[model samples]
Target: MVGLYMVPPDNAVVLSVDEKTQMQALDRTQPLLPMRPGQIARRTHDYTRHGTASLYAAFDVATGKVLGSVTQQHRGADFVRFLEKIDRTLPRRRALHLVLDNSSTHKTPEVTAWLAAHPRFTLHFTPTSASWLNAVEGWFAQLERRAVRRGSFTSVSDLRSELRRFIAAHNKYAAKPFVWTQPADVILDSVARASRAMRINSAGH
Candidate 1:
């Protein structure tokens, strides 16, 4: 998968596909405090939940553009719809390769049937417990920090609107392909060390 990130298949499009689920549409109890020269901006800790939304997004590896859908449920049917959207958005001539995690929703019979019908599309599963390999995860993190965290929403619709707006602005202005800098050997060594440390700590416990 790391190799795929560095050098994708010839004449094919690679997309990092994932869902950001249960995004709460929270409204603060009080208005935000405006920042002045000496004071930092502050928002109330207590918030009221309007609702929740799930965002399914595909991050284009070559162009760094995101095509996304907001859904009320994170079900297999909803994932299939997102796949359909990707199919419609991309050129028919190119083969599509999607990097995904092992989510139950992604492997349902409905999704399997859809993929069977779309011969041009292929799926590549990341290693278990390793979402860091998926480029879309980085994009999702950015969305959380820049847009969702400070946002005040009146309803689920408002949250969805904000998500759409953010994705559009990102594609227009901030979109860039995610770069995987660490070599395979370096990554493996780091993982091995971490595993050993975890084992040692467990033994001590």
Candidate 2:
């Protein structure tokens, strides 16, 4: 993953893709307290659940810009639609190399068929339990912290609107290429040591 981020294919776009599933549209039970000079903002503990939304997002490694969609269902068909959106946005001449996790939706027959039809797209799956290797996860964390967390939404539509606004703001103000500073060998060595330790502990048990 580090190697791919550091040295991506020429004339190809590298994207880290993932989904933020089951995001609740929660409305606070009571009005939130406004922050003053000496007090911080506070919200009620209880909330009314309006509905849920699934966010399918793709982060371009070369440019911190993100392409995303909100869906009611997270089925393979929805994923295909997201991929199609990405396909339409990119230039036909440039290939798309996507780093993704081993999610069933990504590997479903529908998605695989679409990929087969679009030879310009290449899928690269990170190792199991290593989703952190995908740069998109970091972006997701930022989104949750900045946009979703501590937010009060009256309905699913409100939540979706806020998400879209956040993405647009990020693209306009904060978009920049993510650089991987850690060397590939250093990451590999650490993974190797952890694997050896796990094996030794298993043998002992």
Candidate 3:
């Protein structure tokens, strides 16, 4: 099944996988401040330390759905765990095409061997340093803006709970396909211009 997100209705699933790191588990029991005039607000500079965890997230581009797991490590094994979760997200019969970056964990021999064995699942790597090409990166940015940045959790479990809550809340009413605002020709033209400029500069040396 190809043209997963663009053609047909749910014939295929496009899963974008990635990992976010160094999430500190901070505990702040108090409620966040509401916007008000002359409100200096309050924040805990030093929160109770409950260790940290790396979030391995998978987003379904077509459905606006997300599946995530938090662990202390972001390695191949952890990525495999996220893959298992992705499997659980979609039904057994449908095919899944994964879009991901070429992180070391993603290209380990074990992962390659696993993919080799599972012909039904295909992995597509985004261009190097072009993670923005992955739809899930946008979802991650939303997660950071809403549930992660400047947010505090009392413990690892609390962090997990908050993420679960955020996902649940999001699934309740959030679903939109990303529109391609820029045409392919426009992008190609921009790239060609940059390449021409680079070549001219190099010839001067």
Count residue pairs with overlapping backbones in model 3: 2
Report the poorest 10 consecutive residues by lDDT, candidate 2. 190-199
Decide which is better by lDDT, 1 or 2. 1
CA lDDT, every prediction?
0.89, 0.88, 0.73
Of 1 and 3, the candidate ahead on TM-score is: 1
Model 3 residue pairs with clashes: 26-153, 27-154
Clashing pairs in 1: none
Residues 1-205 of candidate 3: C-alpha lDDT, one tens digit per residue: 1234345245667777788888777776556667588886556455577877778877777667777787889888778777777777678788888878878999888788777876668888765545566777787788787887668887888887777787778777785665445666665565466557757777998
Per-residue alpha-carbon lDDT of candidate 1 for residues 48-126, written as tens digits (9 for 90 to 100): 9998999999999889999999999999999999999999999999999999998999999999999999999999986
Error of 2 at 64 (Å): 0.5
> TM-score for each prediction?
0.88, 0.88, 0.78
What is the descending lDDT order?
1, 2, 3
C-alpha lDDT of residue 98 in model 3: 85
Supply candidate 3's per-residue lDDT for 196: 74
CA deviation > 4 Å runs, candidate 2: 34-41, 190-205
